[model samples]
Target: MSANTTSFKHVSYLWDEAEAAKLAGDEVALLIYRSNLLGADLRLTNYGGGNTSCKAMAKDPLTGKEVEIMWIKGSGGDIGTLKKSGLAALYVDRLRALRNIYRGIEHEDEMVELFNHCIYDLNSKAPSIDTPLHGFLPFKHIDHLHPDAAIAIAAAKDGEKITQELFGGTIGWVPWQKPGFDLGLQLKECLDKNPGIRGIMLGSHGLFTWGDTAYESYINTLEVIERCADYLEQNYGKKGPVFGGQKVQSLIKADRLSKAAEIAPILRGFCSSERSMVGHFTDDDRVLEFINSNDLDRLAPMGTSCPDHFLRTKISPLVLDLAKDEDLSDVKAVKEKLAPAFDAYRKMYTDYYNTCKHDNSPAIRDANPVIIIYPGVGMFSFSKDKQTARVAAEFYTNAINVMKGAEAVSEYTSLPRQEAFNIEYWLLEEAKLQRMPKPKALSGRVALITGSAGGIGKAIARKFVEEGACVILNDMNAERLAEAAEEFKKDFGKDAYATAELDVTNQPQIEVAMKAAALSFGGVDIIVNNAGLSISKSIEDHSQKDWDLLYDVLVKGQFLVTQAATAVMKKQGMGGDIINIVSKNALVSGPNNAGYGSAKAAQLHLSRLNAAELGADGIRVNVVNPDAVISDSNIWAGGWAEGRAKAYGITVDELPAYYAKRTLLNKIILPADIANACFALTGGLLSKSTGNMINVDGGVAMAFAR
Candidate 1:
């Protein structure tokens, strides 16, 4: 069971000489290299999924003592080729001190401050979320990787059996649990039990390994992978036609390049693999076989190698039978056929969730697969980085191997629906949500705001607090939503506001978050679909993505939240008010604002429709269109209003006046003006007026119809 007696041979390509050298001498270099090594294995780690650490000594500023310190990777840094500057040097003593505090701390801010006070780093990023775990480990050099092979065995249907066979007594296995303090605590116990253990495998997550020397740790990683691969080959021996495809290399190369273009703008700076080894492997039979496997349902219980792999590979890949002579060259045609296949996959996911989830759980995650393969065309994988891509592919590859082996053993079953939901929505796993303090908005009438975390959303949220209504601020940034909630509490006190980090476009999540918010608030009484985004570009410069994103938040998001709120409003029997933060574009014929204008118009209509349908239920809906709101926020801090002012032949200072002059009343509006209007609609002052568009634009009107 000792690391010395483990017979596994090293064959892992997870490290190079540069990394090995860093581990041997410089602790700083070792820390950076170890982080980069973990980052380079994305299939095994992703986005901000993994953590690594190295121990050293720091001269304490206050105590003037040489204190034991652990240099851990700062949060959100890419581990692959990580920089030395990316580390936060925390007092190992402080980290261990926190670990020894058996009484769980109630507030994370207290813990965060304690960490900040002790950790010395020029890096501004937060400490690695796994800092507590690093403190618990005794090794000098610790590495955590989301290795597909290792996680595959750990997440397998007979994961226990597979893990016992591969590492046997050499590794300690912990069942799937939320990472962070809890998992770290469990790991500490496991380590205590297996005192000589060289590594640990977290079920349904990734692998952790460490050693006295860097080479030994890296080599141990290689050895463990080789053992797993060998075990897969021996037990499953899955060979040939793992996938089916022909050499349509030229077509695939062009198609992949075009696909890369679609993703490039969003990914920003990651090195692309448009036609690299990754692209070639995905096109191979092994990947295809993994995707097209018939035993997906039975084997999926093993779980993904890690949760993030779901983002890349989806819950699983889709297998399709394309029609002969289908013109994939016609991009629209290809997209059309691909739609139904993905739809089928999504349907399967829903069925799985419904069958598996318990009554008391949030639903599963985004069902989009990480990889998709076309029989002759090729395969495609998505990730934030190359390491992520490789790790995901490896997971997909080995997941199939495990499933194939399981077919020979017994019926494969995934975690029950409730169990999976628990994992996905574990409070510790849902770090984003747990960080935000509960808003007092939960105690009174409900209020909904669109784009609730950005720009005017934050403003209106503040205003609603002033009006004594508990507000539900909706936004895409779950993290930002948490931060905003803190700000709201600080500004308006704890009872004033709550947030639903709900993507307005995704109706399901919106529904879920809304229901939760309503239940938390007792009932909803107000809604302001203030969620909107604007791209000041002419029609020719507008993209489908831009158009869709604008519409989804402005029109669709508003409509969905309104619908959910109206249902709750009717039951509450108390009158409710919905205010739409429509733009001047909705009333004015403006160039370079086609999408925002059109979506705002739709939003205005949706508002009117709500006014018409729900007015009988004691609910009123209205619109507030602001012409030019001079604000001190980021959106208006730059080229936006300046460009508009220039286009109108005026200086930036004269811009608000120029807009003001167009209105009968030469008044410059603030978000507070719109907020005042929303307050009026929600309060008793405007109960008589429903289905109205109250122009807050100081009498500006480019189109005077209706």
Candidate 2:
């Protein structure tokens, strides 16, 4: 079913009965359909945080007779983007048979292995640990979700009493229990005792609803969440300004972004002790309201109550409380404070681990935080990539909603320390982490390529993305920029890159572009100064306009872009890479090349100067000089190619062959070859080398760096 046009007051309903009818006879397909509809709304569930299931009668391969089968979301799968292959199929009887072994809670990890024997489809995905929660239940369809509204009720101090008052006898309450065989049994007992109940509220957990049919299950889940939201909404504002009223005032929208930009990199650096991380910043109203409130210090430390929220956000966020009179725009002020704060956070986490670790717990993971809360500024979250970082921030937002709702009608309560520790260090969760694929070499880095609409610039952007870095594709041509953006989005993903349309010579435009980059994927870690044009002319023939044009697009443009990017990089307190795409002409003297060659020489020297100036900040500056890369290069366009051929006494079409013949390797250079050198300098092979020039012209004796 597609998204709905109808606006919702409390919780949105997306289930389309007409659409469900199309898959009426196919129970598994119907289950997938229902799961998608429920997952479509964040009011119901967050990404990869919940599961759904359905039981159907299927023909057994051995007996040639119908037997009951269960189809459920598999391990490490998301319901919103789920496909048929993503479901795990199991024989209901085999799953039920595991009860014969009847191991206690001490053997919780062992029950996961027995599920392999219950496979109805030999090639089905491995079953999730939550399988028994649905299999042992008597319902045909079940949904286990962590909706913000439901979690607010489940996480309240008087949650049991609230559940009884809000849901009456229709929904029962289950005390805090780590999900496993024991929890499933408890749920079964609850159902057995409360025969007509629709579902039960899981304390400090989420909501679980069931129905005999897929449609019934979907509606029941929606109705229950909406009822909670309606009740919370009715009582929410009756208690005066939320969160004990605001204690601190927020910065204007513009200053908020600038302050956030100043804060994001330092926080990101703190989190990167184990490995580099990408950052995401949010300055929305909801975050501002929570962080600026009087209860922020109290509520934030209490932590997120939902397991899904806690896992992504960590046990507690690192909170930065600004002095009332201190300036938020001072990078030096913030950095000095963050250094101590980071140290304290790491020590605190390590202490927590040492205090609560099981003998067999996974060795201490990274002690850095995944979320940070800064009052009057904004929130910053970090992870291995932009998407994960963004989701981490979003999950924190969901936590904010829950905290607000719970505080309105009842006191907010987080999971007890022991309970939160048990879930965080759970062996099953450790196994899931181990299963993730290795990250690419350039993973978590963000690159911005100027003149990336086509040719060498576009090729460099593509290479960075292929190596797992997010890129911002910038060019002056709107049409080409759109086309490049479309291709990158299609080939990689929507989050792989963002596009900025601006001329490199424009300082205002350059500033705007860098801001867009910060907003798109946190901050820029790499810059490729590649926007330029070539003018082939002799001393007597060269015009003032020609010299100015070459300098404006090549020399001055690089300076402007670098100047703007440096502010963000230094503020981030994270060292970065700057690659200048100069030319062979920079070091060699050739006929009819005075204008182009001189500008390139200036660019080369400018890069060396930047390398020396920014070295204290750990920012590396380098140059990639390419020659005769004619395949997709715009430099060999207009009259430049023909004029160069005429000067060499060859036809315009022979430019490629002539340039290759002069090279030491006798090879025609391509865009990918230039891309390789850029990657090598920034990808850590020659990471220590800076202010160095690497020629990508195959080989040119005269142009070689000495």
Candidate 3:
């Protein structure tokens, strides 16, 4: 169909000239506003997959002259949340002048170095590799994006003809060229030939739309995409084959959803590197639909929708069939099935790298597959961290949609395997890889911290994040849990932690929290059962309600959380640590504290029992007995600290000093001290110790174990 004859889909344009004029002189503000508007829709751009630029007149810092400056999206920042700092500005004339001295550069490292030398501002962040494309364009506003609908047409076998059919003479067409200075020159030449063209469809790459204003460029992008979407719908929407049929039914012999959860940890372990984390995402509906489809085998082996996704989702996905009648739940059986498949995949990837690599290419990334597909359950995307996994998930999801769209029109085709390899191991991408900070000691580890909103639990959560662990923070207080999550995000990045408001005593809640932890990260590796309370009362004065509450929180709560955490740990087949926050009173009795002390004693014994039972599974259980930790402790707020102070014949202000004097160190125990002991127990520093007690009570003589 031709552009004139095709009825295109209607899209809502988010442009407002009034809003654009509000920040007319401020280029960065205008860019941020328009970038956010375009980025808000995933159909236009996926996470970190697009770049936008504005050519603005600004006073050069060095020479007070009004120069044309190109402000483009910087690397390693999302367009949706882009700030002024996210853009790297360069002098347009100076940047363009590099074309004179630059010969056809073959190596990406040299190209990147040449590009970096063009930076007009030393303080600006590094610009995207596509910055040259933006600089070469004549228009004042330009946007380069990997819109799925646009990519559906761009990735087709007849993509150039498809581009002509959709946009006719208004948009120019450029064949796939590895993005660099030469490609930028080629794009400029294409636009120069078609001076009236409003956009460019980059075969096997993406789309570029440009105009004199941000609104104009954004509207042009939307109109072209809408036209493509409409063309796809008219040609393939009604004619496409229905997804469900006899093949889907045949593949559903056993429950795959449950099976997926069973196999996720195993898959995670196989994909994880010693230094990099491998987070898993198994609950996306698009992933489920794609994996469950009968055409998955045919579609998955096809290359990615665009070369840009190679860095995140890899060139293709790995498919595993878990539909056999054998016991799929057994870890050993799952591992046996996966071992051969993983070996085969690695061999294939290694062969591809060896055959396609050039002298300038970076070292091959780990041959492990980033995305995994199973017949019955769903697909899983893995990465070095949760945020990257989520990004890969989004890209893969969109990739599936693009493939489906392409299949409906015709057959889906990807960039050549050689081209994909070229992009995957390109020097520019390798530079970014090299810039990534070295992984911390606990980089791939996941930890669950109960009562993490405050006190020792919060401190431990902070320590875990600092050591490069993904933490799931749980607290009974909903408000405090949210606050703690915010604080954690502020301290670390948002991907470092997740929060669950949990009442640990309840079995159902505990189970849900455990699943959340598994889904948030891959599986639980370390658990801090720090959620507890205390009631100061004699055996006679401790009422039935008070005694039950103490037991429910201090003793039974640990039991429930431990049971849940251990189930995940066993499935993971990775040894883990479980540290119970008991009390110094557990080892030595104190008057008028029977309810708290007895419950703590029960918890200590529970730890010993767990250590014995779980030793076979490579899970260690230990206790951290902390006393007089009044600073920032919620346990001391419920009239317990005041009551203890009264027993010592002192005020609450003097109680800390009194307790310090009783211990040999004569130092008051702080929350941080307890956190340090917890870290020591679980941080692989004392890996050989289990069923052991570490005291943070300033060295009490009676509490010390013989």
Candidate 4:
């Protein structure tokens, strides 16, 4: 069957003979290998969307004999990255015994507790809820996947008929049943009735296939999906037009992306009424096709048929309807529709909970759509983090594929409302949600910081990321930015940090940096204006170039960054924070520091004016004054320490002690101390305080704000 699956139009086979040969004897490794292959392609399964299992013989510690055990992908684990530790190991004989004691489908959920008693390994992860399906089936190896192509057929009105038509008698069909002991029994019955079948199409669910070996089962799943996809493609092509043809023309690429960015923050604000949401935008051709199509109105509200798709995306997506000739660039027009659209969606979701929720159901979660389908642009997906938001978009695209395939061939069918509600608010699912760690201080926030390649700037960037903020680290040095980004990726993750080559003094570069923040993680919620240089010189020695360099990076840089970032803030209607990394020199008199001190004073005054101006927009401006953050400071690295020491009538080696003794507390300051003050201002601690300054200088009384 794998040999015949040489060239697949809709999906990749991805089975490697050399790779399989390495894990020939380790049944569990082969299972993981096969599962990864099936999960590698989105055409096969969405992220964390499917289960695979292998029934093998292992030596039993208690019995001192070989016993049949099942190794299956664990609950909440993705098959594509399935590790041995991620696999739940259970006694196959014990798992099968639970069927005998099952009261009926009405009390099938009780079986989950019974599964714990059958555990063969103490350290294995919790078994998936589909354990019954794998254990009840009389196969050595099994694959249950929510491949879009297979689901399209499973969700068709004539799904059962389509299964037989495509696979002849090689694959049987089971009626619609949610995953539980009862559905397991139904699958068992269908297989018992059909002699020598390759797999079964579980109605409004997914495809299940089995074989004697892991490779054979993997190949069978692929062959079944390929054939179903091929059949659907033929019928889809013969039927003409996706989603009943386009009703509106799509906006051009630049206009579309610009529009998506323009509306993204507004949508994010609306979705974040209960809690903040990071957003991801996609203008893929298929998404545009669906949104611009005539049938979009009819199909989007019907929701997704697959449980996996519905889980991440919510029960249904909110569609933003627009007229055929609506002006895509008129953001004001789109903005006006958004409030009513979101209000209606919230009301609908609330009604769904009221109608479907039981007394024991977990309290209603945030009643906002995870996915928003917009006309003229594309889709916007929102979640607690960038990665989750991206994954939500990916899952919705899978649903789009399913809808396209189903509608083209046969009628696309959504899951029954009650079933979807049941699955969404299921007690087991609620437990999983409850188990997740509490959100961090800056979760769902995006921060843009300049001069973040080193010193206090990079320190602040790292702290924001640690507190759950996605960051755009900006620097004039591209190499330094790349180096910092790699450190961030290594320490935290790639999704947590992005880099933009920016000279804060360059207005155009600052604008580009702001756009990078928007395009990477929705929009900016915080800005740290920390980029600067020291050009210390006496009145006689000061040059025009020295003054411009000091003022350009220190004073002008802050202004440009604030201007660009605040523009985005006002559009979001969510407000934001701007922190200026000022200096003790801003207030204290110093020698050989005329250019640097005046620029610092300018930065300080600009921050105060901004605080007063942007307060109406709910934007806060604050300042952090550090006396001598010499360690890891870019200013010090660029010969500022030597200049300051020479001016103080001391050597560079004694500069730290000299600055420390001048402070009331007699302590040298560090970058991390400055970073902490920044976090306190923006991390919700000083939420009500703005236009204020925090001294992280070990008590510089002379520089204290009066």
Candidate 5:
């Protein structure tokens, strides 16, 4: 099924008015309620990426004296899912004291500790990263969100103009600033300038609204977003292309298992951690064309839904259209082609940052896109968690809709590149970077890998960390799963990953893993279906059990993982990448491995099918077919190779030579080789390619079944 590209509708959240009213009189509860309502309205703050606060008088537990305290959203709690425990009660005096101290730390290692100390309530979970800002606000109730609608208008050419038009003189507009102290200062200045203003508009960022009551605060936010949405509709006229029930592509069976194994460790990291991740799946060419558009020169830098969204969806989408148009329809080949464009885009981004630094010193986000949208296809957003993805998707779709509208007029003109850079590298934006250290490549991004505890799956997880991705490592072996996690840390560093002990073949486990990954990483962006089990017996000797085992891990597991990941990706709206590790066996028939070969063949076709169906969502699903390269360490351990060599009437030494001579490269293929292919498929370089399969095996085309 195609993703939901339909325009948004106003539907009330599962908000309990009576419950909210119950918190009205109590200052602390009122603040929590306001935050809850605010988050419910804007997908951006859903699980609580944002925070809320109220400064009120409360008796100190230590002393009889009453003092002002701020009740703020607790750390790591989704504002939409908040409870009393989700709030931190920090002393206003202490908070104010910290405000007076200049933030001395700049680098992340120094900042995370300082941020940790900034918390006011130890009993409460970690405080919101915006605690300092919350402390600065004078209002009794403050609500902040990476609102989808507001961001849509804010990240555009005339965002300020639109804000001015929508709220008239009542709203305060601040250019993007980093969130903590810098944003707090900016917010304070705005509040100081307009004491009666109901809300604040962050340029290329989010929306902050305050009121005397929770309902009032929520209503104001609702009014603002609605106004912006209405303005967009009137200006742009909403309607996207309708897919006429075209059959979308999916991954093949054998490729699926191999990919599952490869992506498992990363998936485990995300699922086991509190963070969540989501991924998109598709390999449609038209969709890729949209993503890799050179038109970015005329448009603004597309980002996650808002500033906070960066934590979920990184900074840019990996354009994937090149796969469809390339001569070799393979993940690796297309990635090579896309490198120049991606580098160009990065260089351009750096130039823009330089221009916008206005100050001699400036902070810049890494040259990675959090949301990836393939034109004429779809888009995907990655986050450490699901809430982040949901918010990103909402804003991204709306922004794209508006951009489409602008295109209809003349050409879509977003904020100037420099202006986008200003927001992207704002101090408030910078403050968020201070709180948590980024993992390797896919750090904030989510990954799902099957059979991650062993062999190639484990290797892929390690590689992703080196590049900065939070992974959900999955495997059926509980003992191996623990061992892999330890091995990853030992190889990479302390706290290098997360893991889940799951049988990828079971749809239930796959679904659970998907949700868990989202919660762990905030959202998923990459899926590597790299789990597989081989049967050595020939076709006549192959039992149904063997067929089922091979098919379950190789084909069905991929489908289940992709299916779940795609749901989260579509909601996130930034698009996603799915990589399938298939075998050259799909291309060449082999003895004693017919069941495995048949499964691999089906998997190859399936990858293409997924690409077609999910293309509209900007998902890129690709396959990597590797020739025989002895992946199963267990096989070597069990003397299976020696036994097979005897059966083939060849010495064991000759077997290795036999496989090597068959390939053009004449090189030994390692797990790292396949890992490289998977990397190219999901990273920003191959942003435009999808549904293509590249052969990694030595020149053996003996199984050319496609």
Candidate 6:
């Protein structure tokens, strides 16, 4: 089945009567439940791209009496995971009073402030911009959404006639207007003129449905969307020759683009800004089908599928031509092709901004394309981090589907360019952008940590993320890596990090991981060679296999991953840091630890060599030598702790105390201590230091530098 056909179905009312009965008196609880049901379905709305509201009776703050109030989704909150705090409560009468002063409100900024002033409680969050439209309607519940199927119908040239035909005058149609007090008033007027309508469709915008209860409004939304989906399927489901049987061309498959991995980094580097690292997403089959179509060049640049998407995707995407036979891996070819294309794209963006922006408009956003359409390879989405890029990709992916459905029925149309500009440069959106928190120290940087499932490596990964760096976790254990990624997501957002299951000693896998890091998070800013295994054996008893195993992981693996990462750093023309998590054994060896000490010593020397050779490229190589960090450490697992405890003539539980008392400072070393040293070296705190080994052993005399 086609992508559109697979998702087409009758409306499924997800309301559970038992659950609703439990929340009978709690309108907010019922509202959240129904909102989640609508938001969870991508067919209904994109992430955080819809609003819902319900009118209920609540005690007034000023007067000790109950009054009618409206609880609506707040700005910047996702409906799928919305909570009580995500909905801002407003006094219904106070919000409705804005219509009296609506004629006097001249600026959008004033309108936004007036809406904020209508909050029922002083501590409540700022209500959504569309709250006025929700409050003005006479219904007790309302939902406004940009469903793909509904969008396809609303964006068509004959959208009004289609709405009338499908709903039989049950749905009112309003012409496109910039959303604010004026548009809300227009919607109120439209409903008054057309009595008994179940919903309203904003031209080139989306759908709005209302009823006496949350379930009624939600089902109305679902039924309207299903009707649009059914209309498209019934009228345009058949395949036929259009344009006088010119033999329409098919798009190239993604698998045919062998060099997508290599080209991803180049495109990322080309699109990056001074303050932002450009994360990338290589297209899947659906995207490849859309970008490779015969009508791509014409349809792609016309406009976005929805006006709200213009802020994320821009008015149009940047189009590039990649020949099938070109070697994308070649540095010279990538530079020659991408450099000029990026320059032209920037120029076009500047021209558009200059032509559309008014004196009162906020400053133009950065002149960079959010979406990139490549003819041969596929398409890509660029953003400061992975999550934002994913959201843009999701919207554009849906856009392709909507465009296809619209084209199948009638010509696909978008709001005029000026209308798009009005929303894109609106003061309210600009305020939202300005409200973002300041960038952290390592913002827009990518760090890769080997053996990141536990211990020092994991600690380092967490530190990087805390400082606003996108971390890529690598471990041989896939299960541990997945768990670590999920744990990190709880603190940092899901897009702040990525994971790869990798055996550092595998050369092929090392190369793939390097490319994956670059593709997933633009390019590498830091590389931590922290993956190693410890073995204890006498010199006479140590086998060649044991020695080789240590060397392959501790020495050889570091060399391979570093070499690959350095190449990408060079391509990006950005300096980087290479930190090796060596052991104190490198400086002072213990008995029966020959293999481990020898490999670590070799890695320490290799780091100095890399530092000497790569200094000209601004890449700093440093070493963090830590010793006896047993807490939450994986290296001490599998009888190693017991063996060490036996050697020290102490119980396993007291082994930590024994080591702590041995140091001059009588302090125990922890993984976080080593991580802090690593962070200090790489985060420009010790910018002038390189090829230097910093100790985290709480005063190890034997391991001290001369």
Candidate of highest TM-score? 4
Candidate 2 wrong stretches, greater than 4 Å: 1-8, 323-330, 649-654, 661-666
Better of 3 and 5 by TM-score: 3
lDDT of each: 0.61, 0.88, 0.80, 0.87, 0.62, 0.81
TM-score of predicted structure 3: 0.91
- The residue-by-residue lDDT of candidate 2 on 631-652, one tens digit each, is 7778888988888988999998
Displacement of residue 98 (Cα, Å) in model 5 is 6.6
Q: Report the lDDT tens digits of candidate 1 across residue range 1-706.
A: 1233244442325456654664665776766765665566543355555677778776777778887888777765667756777677887776777755545633332455466766655454567557777778888888777665566576666777767666767877888765566567788899999889878888766788887765566666656766665665564434432222222332354453333322221111111212111121244555444444444323443454456455345555654455322343444454455567666766777776777665644546545445544444434444432344445655566455445433433223344445555455544445654564543221234577766675676777777776555677767778878888888778866545556778878888776665544333434556777766566677887889989888877887788878877655544445667888887678677767787788878887887888888877777888887667776343465466765765687788887778778888888787787777777666666668888877778876565546
Clashing pairs for predicted structure model 3, backbone only: none
- Which is superior by lDDT, 4 or 6? 4
In model 6, the runs with Cα more than 4 Å from the true position are 1-12, 237-258, 489-493, 638-654, 684-689
Q: How many residue pairs clash in each candidate?
A: 24, 0, 0, 0, 153, 0
Error of model 6, residue 368, in angstroms: 1.8
At residue 633, candidate 5 shows an lDDT of: 44
Provide the global lDDT of candidate 6 against the true structure.
Answer: 0.81
| Residue range with the least summed lDDT across 10 consecutive positions in model 1 | 268-277
Write candidate 3's Cα lDDT for 643-665 as tens digits.
78776778989988898999999
Least accurate stretch of 10 residues (summed lDDT) in model 4?
322-331
Q: Using TM-score, rank the candidates from best to worst.
A: 4, 2, 6, 3, 5, 1
- TM-scores of all candidate predictions against the true structure: 0.48, 0.95, 0.91, 0.95, 0.50, 0.93
Candidate 4 per-residue lDDT, tens place, 150-235, comes to: 99988999888888877887999987788988888888888899979999888888989999999789778878888988888788
Candidate 5 is scored at a TM of 0.50
Instruction: Write one digit per residue (lDDT tens) for candidate 5, span 393-469.
Output: 55444444445434432234344445455456655446655776654445556677787887787777777877777
Prediction 3 global C-alpha lDDT: 0.80
User: Which ten contiguous residues of candidate 3 have the minimum total lDDT?
Assistant: 1-10
C-alpha displacement of 697 in model 5, angstroms?
34
